[model samples]
Target: MSTTPRDRIGLVLSGDVLEIGPGSRPFTVAPGANVQYADRAVEGGRDQNWPELIGQPAGVQAHYDLNLDTDGLAPFRSGSLDGVVASHVLEHVANPLEVIAEFGRALRFGGKLLLVVPDRHQTFDAPRRATPFSTVLTKHREKTTEVDEASIRDFCQAIYGQPPIHPTEVREWHNPAMLDADRLALHRRRSIHVHVWSPEEFASLIVCSLLEGITAWRLESMYFSDHFPARTADEFALVLEKVPFANPNELGRQFVDAWCNSVLDDTAIDPVRLARFEEALRRDCADAAINSLPLQLFAAKHAALGMASTQDRITSLEVELKTTQIRAAEAIAQGKALELSTSWKVTAPLRALRRLFR
Candidate 1:
């Protein structure tokens, strides 16, 4: 429905709008008053998405806050807000389902939410397995409120970006315990992109939630990377609309009827060409894995040898430190003995006289 990225963003938002976690670059500008909660920068400065040193974007207010997005706009009366906006916010939250529910609470029926998320395959998140729908439902059932250790580990694992990078097999030895400690430290920073999905994967979350009557939002419009062919932008923007009377009975039908007239252009992707692309990708990956294993094993051996050399250097430094401490202790004892002598007492007076003269 929209030709440009900016147009797609503007399509879903209008009137008195509330944008969540518009950290440093909010694209939406409404005719009515706009309010945005500037999210705390992820402190470690590792991830580029939510950075620590970035200056606050225009119209970003620190006062408009949530303890976390889980407490989403409880004070607003039902059917009060015209629109809600969140970009790259859902993945980091502990409970995304609750975040959506809270946003839906304040939005008037027919109000839209503009959600933009990273296309995992295009970002550093390429290595992560797509989160199963069941995992999302599980979090909703348990009412999860804290980021887990497992999530942090996946975020830490280095992944290449789009334009496939040839695998470089470099082996570095890291203690699993130390790595665990590191992951814990990064998690405390709270700037983790915990969930990842392509546009299609995210659509499932919205559609499935509506089907189960868990949420009142339905997919209205979307924009993917193809929309911007001149440049590379990994985020896929979603426009979701909230419908009225969101209960088990009417919610499912409301979602279904809204899409009754939907027509899909199957010609967009030629199935035979798509199949050839998939097969070629799989074949190349399998061949790379087979070729890399031998080199990887030798690299591990080389890394172990390097670790042994470092250990020997550490032991030599420890022995040198012990010898220096012994010599220093002996010198201190000699000075104490000299202070007790009659000659030293006479010298002490001479030293005091010299100090006064100086």
Candidate 2:
């Protein structure tokens, strides 16, 4: 008897199963067995080929938004699901901690969860731009546009540069209430990235969530490191097995938070420093602010239009301010020269009379 690839994969789990965000491509399961797949679009009366995709002899059940963090896990509690597979899905969720907790609840004791996600290290580094507090606030205000369903699509297209048809269908299933419009808009501006995880960070999140449960949890195995070249860019797979009890890493959690907070604080713009900069400009030249107004205006316009980050706008302003100071200094020098040339003898007699009076 020959074992099929699907059989090899399917053998990893022993009982009832759930797959999250299967998307258009479905995983192959064992023959003559039932598995359940959940997605938002499937629940919304959208056409889905889940039955054909699962391809199990007994067929598969489908649920919409079953795996969402906020959604109640009554379905899983109603019956035991031994396994849950999340593929490239965790990154999109607004609050991953909630989702992980739900997964911990859904799984039976000693069940397994398989997760595949993009490697944060492989993605482009988040941009380093310093923006003014006032500018950031103004940008946030501008983001509160009228909420039209089509507007969401248009915004998506504008940010992503085209309609991402494949991801859009699933993304639309996201409950509107779960999304804070203002926060989402700010996030879109910042970079559609809410979380970037290294392998250690990702694993730590899972382990911490599992500690809330009585079930013991252990990381089973990791797949596709250095061996598969294509996965080097986007994805890595982790298998976590349910256990009796596992200790959550309190120190690790604190460390991660402290590190991230330090990074953000270091990157923040210092208003006091900027004030000092303005004072220096004033002291260096008269009319410094006036002469630099046009450049400052240009930079402000660029920032308003979202063409430049706050840091870039500040740099532009500083350049203009310095130029104004230089021009003012030259004007003062020319004025002093004119005063000296205009009245030599007359000024001397006036100076002698003033000295005699003193």
Candidate 3:
């Protein structure tokens, strides 16, 4: 149906809309117009699909597996949608660049691509280092679909050391399930944070991607959360505008080159450092039996129960101490009152006479 003024409340909500990983509450731009919530699954059965994060169903128009969809938004005809919103969903995908490119492909010219990505510095991924654009490009160029052992080990090492208080659907990591040799299989079964980034790194990544012909989405506005969210805030939001790239101008070339250089300059990884990281991962992965779920869960429960019992004991002791003090005070007051009584002085003379007669 054609969008009318009554259908769209705002200027941006004029046509078809697609929200990837909308979870429970989807972003609604056009109230009466077609809006689709594209999720990996309806139920939280998929390993990577966090039904909890997305929450329960909320009138979601459509559901599809992002893993099987493979092409990201390519299944949708080019220039079909007016906008796409993927909130904190890109970190879980194996190929974020492809997903971003698909966003550009799916939306019509001037359409918006709104992305919310978690900052590693703020979330449980704090232990992890930001993923470089070169690494991302390699995965994209290699067309790697499934995660490898190295990624599994890296993720296990980072998350196990510092688990997210509110983890996405990948809750299995709360225990030692992530350290097992079969972790690669587990990762394949579910989604995990395959990449990490700060807001600056993310912006530079996008810029580099643009220079590499990954997408035509131009950066319109970027926001880094502050104050209430803090520097370690859970995530940052970005808005990109889909535009045609007929020819590259001098200004555009200079802009992309400068950003790319800045991003790449710091990304020159040291081989020795990387080897050390891998060695550390190996050490962590080797201790899978210790990190197993049942053992960890039992330990947590035991700790909690122990603390509760200790508190109860302390409270009992406090009550006993107060009662003892009250009894001692009462005895002292009774003795003082008897000594001051007039009857006690008269009874003392009679007691002396009785003693003399005896």
Candidate 4:
């Protein structure tokens, strides 16, 4: 059968299926059963028949909110499901690795798992913060408040009129109490931005997680939506195929080793650069301490020195200042004559006075 645009964009399923974190609108997969999982539905009601939108056959049944993750669906444990479609759901899950593992477990060998996640590089509406390791450590030492998951969810609901749901569970690894109210309040001041992954980093993490037995297999290919014309970045889809006979432990170790090596090589810094950074730090510290004296102290010291140096010159100015006073005396005499002419009948009175005086 010809694949539809949604299938090309996401999972192209042919039979029985599972859809994780479907939110409000579950994907439409005709001729198959679709199961969706989410935390909360719209207040008025939940869409029990959301799968009908996918135009499934009349006998096809739809199950909603099975809460599979909380229900203990293990990797490689679920009998073969033909396909799995997870769309815009991974970001809200606390442990995406476990969810992916569950998907791997549920799929039949050669079965496809289609994952769609918002590209952190392109998604701006989401709350995100990226801090360096040093800054993170510093904040930890300072005992700053942090925002937790529940508050974040509440914030999302308040701002976007939607409940905040984490797509991945990895963030929970950083702070498990993110869902709790009291704990959330303690960290509420600091953004609960526990994790934000760039496109490359996200792909690498997924690959590493699968290789590490967090999932039962590896991804066959990952496609980004941002580079749609040339390269997509806003959303990404990963096509994963189940590996029936793989050793979980060995695969995990090898994956970890490779991931570590890649990260080290990519982020490695030279000795010269390190030395220069340390030297710069020391110089900045010294300069900051030296410049820490109060402003008033500097102003007072400058004022005293200036007064001492110019004391004699200021005294000499007192004598010359007396001679400069003549200009003021002449100006005062002109002012008295103008005032008398305006206040009195100056034309007749002043003339009579002048005649009498003469």
**TM-score winner:** 1
lDDT of model 3 at residue 337? 92
Q: What's the CA RMSD for each of the models?
A: 24.8, 17.6, 17.4, 20.2
lDDT of 3 by residue, 7-84 (tens): 122225447777777765565464565666777652436333444445445545455556522757656899988888
lDDT of 1 by residue, 239-277 (tens): 788876455434533433332212122222222322222
Candidate 3 colliding pairs, count: 5
Better of 3 and 4 by lDDT: 3
The candidate 2 region of ten consecutive residues with least summed lDDT is 125-134
lDDT of 1 at 271: 24
**TM-score between model 1 and native:** 0.61
Task: List model 2 lDDT by residue over 1-358, tens digit each.
Answer: 3243222443576567788867655555445445678864323132242222234443244565553534545566832778888777666554555455456677877777777776555543122111122221232245422223333333343334324333554344333443466544433322233344544445434433433332245655554333344344355566666554433343223323332332223423222322322333233223532243233433433344343366688999999999999999999998888778857645878888999999
Candidate 4 at 164: error in angstroms?
A: 16
Question: After superposition, which runs of candidate 1 have C-alpha atoms over 4 Å from their true positions?
Answer: 1-3, 38-59, 159-177, 180-185, 246-358
Badly placed stretches (over 4 Å) of model 3 are 1-13, 28-33, 42-61, 163-178, 227-233, 246-358
RMSD of 3: 17.4
Give a tens-digit lDDT track for model 4, residues 1-358.
Answer: 5243344544356566666655445666555544444332322232222322244333323455343334424332475587788777555443455556667777787777777766555665344432222332333345433323543664333324323333333234224434466545433322233444444445445534543335655455444453265443467666666766466544433433333333323322121222222232233223432233232333443454356448878878876787679778888998887767755554767778899988
